[model samples]
Structures are given as structure tokens and as C-alpha cells.
Target: MLQAIRDTHRYSPGELRTALRFLAPLGLLIGIFVLLPVLGTLAGSLYLDTTFLERRFAWFDNYCGLLTDHTFLQSAWFTLTFAAVSVPLELALGLALALLMNSQVRPLGLLRACVLIPWAIPGAISARTWELIYNYNYGLANALLGGLGIVGEPVNWLGTGAGAFAALVLTDVWRTTPFVAIILLTGLQAIPVELYQQAQVDQAGALGRLRRITLPLLRPIIIVALLFRTIDAVRVFDIIYILTRGGPGGSTTSLSLYAYRNFLGGDFGYGSAASALLFVVALGLSLVYIKMARKLKIKMR
Candidate 1:
């Protein structure tokens, strides 16, 4: 690969132009569907736009409001904590489940399909299902806790601030863990069997081989999964909206939900500012993760 770089003269400007031509349509689509909308929202954030009111440019006043908004701060904290907690849990559980599925466990073979069932159900439907599971009375969660003698009485899973937050986290983990598993499983399968065999011949144990070989080779894929999951987790809405409605003292409201409420309440400027901030946060995290991955790769060399 280093030699190939040194021989870069083999590549021509014609090839570069051909590649650009091929990519032009994709760039155009991104500009139309993504860039243009984002630019529009950023512009909208500068206004005092509201329903039945004269549209006026406020120029960062909306953003300034976010600094003093208690609910906004709480929602932002909830959003960050939710992603911080959920993504790692998903990744860990997913790695385990993926390893199990990829093992010689024939009983787990059916799980390849079963794992996707929760994810396949529409988000709205799944959220409703979880709502029932976390219901204050006669719900599966309460029933199980009662049956196991874990709690003396039914817990208000979705009616209390902390309980509601926990419920959201658990529901999200259950719903999205399968997706992480699938991504890891694909990466797991790509690893050469001979590497493991070689490790075994060297008298390496399962744990040793996994840490030394599997994880190191799978770093790039893991980063990809983390990137995708982190972005999705931050933008989470449908499930939270359906389950808790950002209720129980507004302890579980995510930034996306906050923005949505703003939009629904006809405060387009505030909503746009919230959304633009979310975009910045997500983009910043993505860049950080990518840079960390690159740094790790370099360190490995």
C-alpha cells in the first residue's frame, strides 16, 4: 500500500474526473435533500417566526433563550445521558449476542431472525407495546417484579421522573440492541477463521484470542456501528414521544422532542434553533468519534 502511494503517477486526472462525474448525482441529491433543508433551518433559527405573528429576524436571540431555558437544559441533559448510557449498553450486549449467534450454538440460529422482530415492528407500535409493559398497574414489568418478590407493590414505571427515564432507557436498549448485534455480526463473519485457528494453535484461550484478534481487526466496524448508533440515539423521538410523551416532570424529554414541541406550538424559530443545535452536537460527536478511530488506527501502526 505504501509502494502504491509512491507510484501515484499511475493514476490520471482523467480517472479523477470520471470518479467525480460518477459522484455528482449523489452530491446533488445530498445538496437537495440534506444540505438545502439544513441551510433553511439555520436561516430560520435567526427569526422570531411564530404563527399569527409578524415574522421578524431576531438574530441569535432564540439561541440565547436556550441558555436560560430550564426545560431546554433538562432536555439536553436527558438527551446526552440517554445516548451516553444506551449506545454503550447496546454495543456491549450486541457484541455478546453477535458472538453467541456466530458460535456453534445451533439453538441460537433462529435468533438471527428473531432478533429483528422488535426492530421490524413499527416504532409507534413497539413504543405502545412498551408503554403497556411499563404501565402503572397490571403491566408485565410490575407483574414480574411482584412475582419475583422484588417489590412489595406495583411500581409506577412511567409515572415517576426517574422511573420514566429508566423505562425509556430499558425500552430503547431492548428495541435497538438487535441492530447493533446485526452490524457486529456482519463484521464478526468477515474475520478469517484461520486467524482464530492460528491463535488456538498458539495455545491462546478464547478470551485472549478474542481480545487480541477479533477486537483489533473489528475496530473499524465497531467505530462505524458506534457512529451510526450515536447519531440515531441522539435523534431519538418516535419511541420517547409515544411512550412517555416527555412527561413525568419532563425528565425524559429529548432535544428532538423539545424541538418537536416547539414546532407544534408554532414557535418555528425556537424549534429551528433547537434542531440546528442538535445538528451541531451530532456532527461534533461524529467528528470526534471518527478522529478517535483514526488516532487508534495510527497508534496501532
Candidate 2:
């Protein structure tokens, strides 16, 4: 038993030195930025204070208060609903775009570049652009609807709860679907053309080939793309900030926005608790994705 333990744990001095050298930079970064801040936030969340100047350890009081906080609850629900609605739409649109781009069309390179334009634009800029387009009067969206006689008057796209939510979702989908497409496009490109050739030789239809060959092989990439998009969607701030500012009756305030408001209001302890909750939610979703990927036997590189 002693020999086995020694064999398992032992490392030569040179190997130890090499390992430390490789790990040093990453360890330093994690310690300074990620580890210390998380520890501080967790510690801070347990206290009751205004700006940490007169803090008192409150144990789980802050968490308990959070559960009953209407604004926080609403923001949490909004964040979840936003992610739920937008991520799937983005994925579907992205997959469609990837399929279109993956086709053997003329000027495919140019088409791919054009498709990246929306994703290349900064989030704030895109949000502002969408805001203009969704404006009540003289906006392109309203003008188009009027031109097509779809509505008798301009619809207030961001003036009501449902409209604001829909507008936010639309803006997010427009800005993010391209990113999903680019990731999935790389995945689609990685698929061996020979598989399709074999399927064709077996007299498989296009839909059959896609269902049996393309999707199964692309499962890992799809999972990865969804994971990335879901994380981004959950923490979405800049776009919402620029477009709505959680306005039109606080209908679209997200968890991040709620935390920001609390922090700005000098409730550091509660703000930290909110931020910690956000971290936990993001971490939990990521773990779920990892488990699903593993269950699907998808090898990630």
C-alpha cells in the first residue's frame, strides 16, 4: 500500500518544476481575479451593510430577503424567460443559416462574411439600431408594416410589457443568431462529405440524410453552441441597458440590472448576494450542459 501510494504521488524534481512553470500564470490569474473576488463576494453576501462601512454578519438573512424581494424575483423570471425564448430561436435560425451557407453556392466566402456583419457589430450599437427601427413613428418596422397594410397604425413596439419583452427578444436574436451560425457552420464544415455521399448512394433523401447523418454527428458542436449562447443570454446587459434600460414599467429588468441597481443604491451586501446567485445559476446551467454532452457520448476537444 505504501509503495502504491508513493508511486501514485511521486514526481521527479524536473517534472515538478516543469508542471509548476506551466501552471504559474494561470494560477496567478485565478487567484487574483476569479478566486479572490468570488471569496470576497460570498463573504460579503453574509453581512448586512451599506457599502460595507458598518457591516454585521447576517448569515442567511440576505438570501431569505432575496427570496421575498419582488424586484429580484421578477428580474430572475425575466432573465430565465429571455434566455429560454431567445436561445432556442437563435439556435434554430443559426442552424438554418448554417445550412444555407454550407450549401455549394456561388461566392460562398462572400456570403459567409456578409452573414457575420450583425455579429461583428458591437452589442450597444446593434441595440441602438434596433431601438430606432422599433421606434413608434417613422421607424422602418412600422413603415414596413403600414406599407404592407398589416397594421392600420404604428404599433408601439417597446411601449408595453409584452411589446418590450418581444422587442428585447427580437434584438437579442438578431444580434446573436449569427454567432450561433458561425459556430454551427464550423461544425457543419467539419462533418465528412463522404458520409453524405454514402447516404446518397443508399438512396437516402435530404431530410433523412440530415436527420441520420448531419445532426447526430453535429451533436457535440450543437451542445457547445447552445451552452455558449445560453450563458451569454443569461448575463445579457449591454443590449438591454441600451435599448430599454429596464423601462416601460420595469418589465424587462434582468438579474444583472437588478444587482446593478442594488449596488448603486448602496446595498453592497444584497448586491453581492444577487451577483453570487447569478454566478450559481450560470454555473448550474453549464454543469447541466456538460452532463448532457457526456450522456450523449459527445467527445469535446
Top candidate by TM-score: 1
> Model 2: how far is 45 from its true place, Å?
1.0
lDDT digits (tens) for residues 1-301 of candidate 2: 1121133367899999999999999999999999999999999999896765778999988899999999889999999999999999999999999999999887999988888999999999999899889988878899999999999978988899898999999999998899999999988998888889999999999999989988887888898999999999899899889888998899899999998988999999999999899989998999999898777762322
lDDT of 2 at 198: 95
Report the lDDT tens digits of candidate 1 across residue range 217-283. Answer: 7787799889999999999999898988898778889999999999999999999999999999999
RMSD of 1: 2.5
Q: Give the whole-model CA lDDT for all candidates, comma-separated.
A: 0.89, 0.90
After superposing candidate 2, which stretches have Cα over 4 Å from the reference? 1-20, 298-301
- The Cα error of candidate 1 at residue 290, in Å, is 1.2
161, model 2: CA deviation in Å? 1.1
Q: Using Cα atoms with residue i matched to residue i, what is each candidate's TM-score against the true structure?
A: 0.93, 0.90
